[model samples]
Target: MCIVYAIDSDWGWYYFGCSTCNKKVFKVGTNVRTLNGQEITSHIWWCEVCKENVSFVSPRFKLHLVVKDDTGEARLMLLDMVASGLISESATELLNGSFDELEDPDELPEAITQIFGKTFTF
Candidate 1:
């Protein structure tokens, strides 16, 4: 068993993925078009696996944790499903708005921080 001590929040806690394929999506550019004579620009994300621009993306958990045991300490990565089971809230739920809205992008949410000092078998 290992006890969770700290969370590596430097990279933030989640990644935007294609809603359909559930694969990581990269922001390619902005799509500008005219709708009803009004010009609109929307962010475009490309999913490598999907091989297309995905208009809908969802935030998925990608938590990095620092854990320790008798031997030493090690870093652990918990993806969407595992993290969702441990935390009670989905990444989408915790991130109520776009990433830009966060006061500190590197800060961990209260729910995720609660794992600190808890022991679990990897």
Candidate 2:
């Protein structure tokens, strides 16, 4: 059970965010080359509450993330991280869990509980 957290948006959709910054990317692109030799385009979604950008391909799959030294460097790092083992374990775990739920599109709050096997008494 490797997972960090999730990031939902206002467009009735959601995406997996970085462990450090929980941002959700609405638009996703791929198969492009980056300056760091990462051959993939990332769709970035910015988070208003947290003020960060997240790159996600789909609900169940998240390309590797390239984190940066500074907050402003997120865009560049994200691409590099994709398809590469450059992200933290916690971050990967968290993203995967959230994405799994999105993939189902049928499970709601119950989906989360079912996967994690923890009950949220709300």
Candidate 3:
């Protein structure tokens, strides 16, 4: 069990991952040449490790939390499922909602802010 004292939204808390290999991916645009000598640009989710273009992307969360009890304070990295449970919202929602709004800790969404001062069983 742990109590959440703060959500460190200073860094990006969520990321887009490759659905196939489950690795971090970047949204990128690439130019493609057609057989007819036409050049076309396309946007895709690219995984450098996988070295391929992926159609499906899954949301992943990597959150830094400040949690404490009577003992002392500690910093924790909560990822994916655990992070979802802490905020009572799935990573997909976080991605779709206000993830882009997280330029600063003070700019965190209410969904994340509501987790402050909340306790849960790990």
Candidate 4:
């Protein structure tokens, strides 16, 4: 994972070439709250060295790459606490689809595990 620090408070974001191949990339600020609703600010940095996305928040927080292969696919992920309020390793389910526009922080599918898994980790 690419670990980077916030360089400026004006813009908690950094724009640079992805280390993968000097591709123009950026690391944006992500204010991720913990399981307890504690705001754990961090950034999802596009690794210049590893060429991968990494977290720059509390090392105690547990974050995993959430990949969506479905249509309208965006580089979305599941960010949550490691072990505190919810079980780890779960997937976010579609609350309603095939007709209406989807919103963030949807519900969980059968056999739900973590709260963070559903984008409501904060």
My TM-score estimates for the predictions, one after another, are: 0.83, 0.27, 0.72, 0.22
Can you tell me which runs of candidate 4 are displaced by over 4 Å? Answer: 1-25, 56-122
Query: Over the stretch 1-122, how does candidate 1's per-residue lDDT look in tens digits?
Result: 99999989877789988989998999888779999999987888999998998889888998899999999999989989888888877888888856333668667788888889999897
- Sort by lDDT, best first: 1, 3, 2, 4
- What digit string (tens of lDDT, one per residue) describes model 3 on residues 1-122? 67888877766677777888878888775556576787755447789889998757777887888889888888888877677766767778766743233445456657777888888665
Question: What is the lDDT of every predicted structure here?
Answer: 0.85, 0.35, 0.73, 0.33
Q: What TM-score, to 2 decimals, does candidate 3 have?
A: 0.72
Candidate 4 lDDT, tens digit per residue, 18-65? 334434334555557686867665556565566677553121112233
The superposed Cα distance between candidate 1 and the true structure at residue 21, in angstroms, equals 1.6
Per-residue lDDT for 16 in model 4? 35
Q: Which residue window of length 10 is worst by lDDT in model 3?
A: 97-106
Candidate 1 vs candidate 3: which has greater TM-score?
1
Best by TM-score: 1
The per-residue C-alpha lDDT of model 1 at residue 1 equals 98
Question: Highest lDDT, which number?
Answer: 1
Question: 1-122, model 2: which lDDT tens digit per residue?
Answer: 12312312222223454444434444433345677765655445555555655553333223321123322222121232341232234333445544333554333333322323221111
